[model samples]
Target: MRDRPEAAPGAAPAGVAGKKSGNWKDLRARVLSAAVLVPCVALCVWAGGLLYGALIVLAMAGMAMEWARLFGFGLETRRGQLCLAWAACVGGTALAGHWGGALLVMVAAVVLGPALWAGQVAIGCAGLSLLWLRYMSEPGAGVVLFLVACVALSDTGAYMTGRVFGGPKLAPRISPAKTWSGSIGGMCCAVLGGMLIAVMLPGALPGAVWRGALFGGLVAIAAQIGDLGESALKRACNVKDSGTILPGHGGLLDRFDGLLVAAPMAALLSLGAAGGIAFWYVGLH
Candidate 1:
């Protein structure tokens, strides 16, 4: 028999070292991706015309591809083609101000592929809501920015808090990394962001801290729910992520899951309010 090898003089076990290092293994890639994409997204949102529309189209296409993959469909497959077609119609109709046609298309797709088309419809409606908020709402860019900022803050806060204060899982079966601490931390961060936006953009938002906080809380809840929903879907599909288009982020759908549901909710609230996008703080006119 061969002699056993001696341990290193002062070395920790490989598993221990690995656990420590792996805690933030993906941070660098996540930061780098955000650094590159955030500025581009902000610029496009600020310049809400062809540039923004193009960004939306590109995102929808990426999301559609990911959705198809989640369902075990290749781009050349009939289901994949239908998914892409739905994506195209949604983007085209949203940009062309024909949202009614988009709704009809969504219904048709749902009927054609009931199992796969539900999420596609949600994503399509989100795109439509974003377009409506940008081109049709009173606050336009400011409202979109506010929505983006709150969701971003929530996501960031949840990630940071979950890593630092590991505890009971929020939904271990769906996403083991998520925790109750992270969820609360995210909601708090979102509230702060909302209040800050209200202060900075008094013309676009109401001046009441309570209203800002309320709006932030609601958006955070919606965003978190969206995140959980996507996680469940990924779990059901037996996948770790929706796709791999964005390094560390997995895919466009993974990154924008929160925004997907939140946008439509925000738009619906705005539509029913007297002040449109600024209705969070503004009273009935």
Candidate 2:
């Protein structure tokens, strides 16, 4: 067994201090990235239609590339094949309304990706599913925007509350930084912000604000779960961050990990009456 060297009398622990210092840099980078990303996301949402679709597809493609790189497939021919399949899955679903193609890709990934590229497969499928959430749902774009906003608010709440309170860890093994205080704070923010947005809608649905609050709270829950899932993946893969693609966020996957799982689940909850798309806007007057 190797020995852990003792710290000097007045000096900080060997690696701990460095980690603490790096955190500030990471947080600052996150803020800088958010400053640019938030406006762009809002604009695309407002624009709607092809603009939003194209942007999301591009992101998915980028994520696919990054996933392959993460799996050490960057230099292999499989990387191109996987990336192409991923783009087809996302773009097909977005442009041509094709779920079968995406499904096929998932099946192929499972069969061929058991040993390697499983994460890539999951990323591609999840990315496409989210795109489908935006593309296929009736009044989908609005719901997508709401989900994104709630998740964003939840993240902000978690960060602020966790830092301020510094209480018990929520899932110490999965994510050391998470805490119970952060969870509660995130949920509260989600509910309150969702209600506010619900009230501001053009035609407010009956109990729309309350229901929206619930939706937001649920979103926070899902986002946290996704965050944990990603953390676990990182732990298993023995890496930090997916990539350096995003200035502060690390990679597209790192930034949007929460949305990967949350979007699809939310879509299911908001399913429409006609067996297609979510009627999430139904109650909105």
Candidate 3:
């Protein structure tokens, strides 16, 4: 048998080098896409009204299309048309401030596609909740921006720490790349980021250090759950990403999975609070 070629002294193995190179390239692409997407999203959130509603509609449409693709349905298929119609109905109802109607449409859509119905419902509800949250008279865009920043920080922290301090996998079956160290790092970053954004924003967010930390931690955990759930779905589908619509981000679903879960969670929490989401954020209730 022929002998395998050996690496030179002080040089890394071919596989390790290749993996690192790929990671760096992927990271660059992610940064570039984020730089463009983040500002647009922020602008919409700040603008509210028609601008924000349009953004949500576009996002819902994109996610619905990608979700259909996940089940092997092409854009020309009947299933794809149903998916688009469902998304339009949901978006239109939610845009008109009829959340109940949007929810009913979501439930009806689930019966049409049972394979990944749960995720579909969750994403739709999240889109509606975001619409509601932004229209809130209190806190308003400040809270939305803060939430986005914290999630982004959590994701960044996890990716960075996981690479720097490789450790035991968090869930080998669902997502082998995630580690406990990375999760912990993400949590810490989320807390810090949340507090920082709250302070920077012109509002009474948190009103206390502990409150901010708690809120941030909850958001981070929810975000992680969302990320893991999406991973599991992709694993079941035997695919790596939902789509290739966004470079480095895979697809709209892939990019906003965490936000999808986190938004509803935040909205529910706010509604349950006595004063509202803004009050809860500020520890007033």
- Please name the candidate that would achieve the greatest lDDT relative to the true structure: 1
The predicted structure with the larger lDDT, 1 or 2, is 1
Model 1 alpha-carbon drift over 4 Å, by segment: 1-18, 202-206, 282-285
RMSD (Cα, Å) of model 1: 7.7
lDDT of each: 0.77, 0.66, 0.74
- For lDDT, candidate 1 versus 3, the one ahead is 1
Off by over 4 Å in 3: 1-14, 277-279
Models ranked on TM-score: 1, 3, 2
- Tens digit of lDDT per residue, candidate 1, span 52-100? 9888877876787788888888788988877877787888877887888
Residue 89 accuracy (lDDT) in model 3: 80
Report the C-alpha lDDT of model 2 over 61-137, residue by residue, as the tens digit.
77676666656667367655666466556465646666676666555655446634465455655666566666665
What's the residue-level lDDT of 77 in candidate 2?
Answer: 74
Candidate 2 deviant stretches above 4 angstroms = 1-23, 75-77, 115-121, 272-285
Relative to the true structure, candidate 2 reaches a TM of 0.82
lDDT (Cα) of model 3: 0.74
Name the better of 1 and 2 by TM-score: 1
Question: lDDT tens digits, residues 85-159, model 3?
Answer: 788788889788787888888888766658646645876888887887888635778778867776777887887
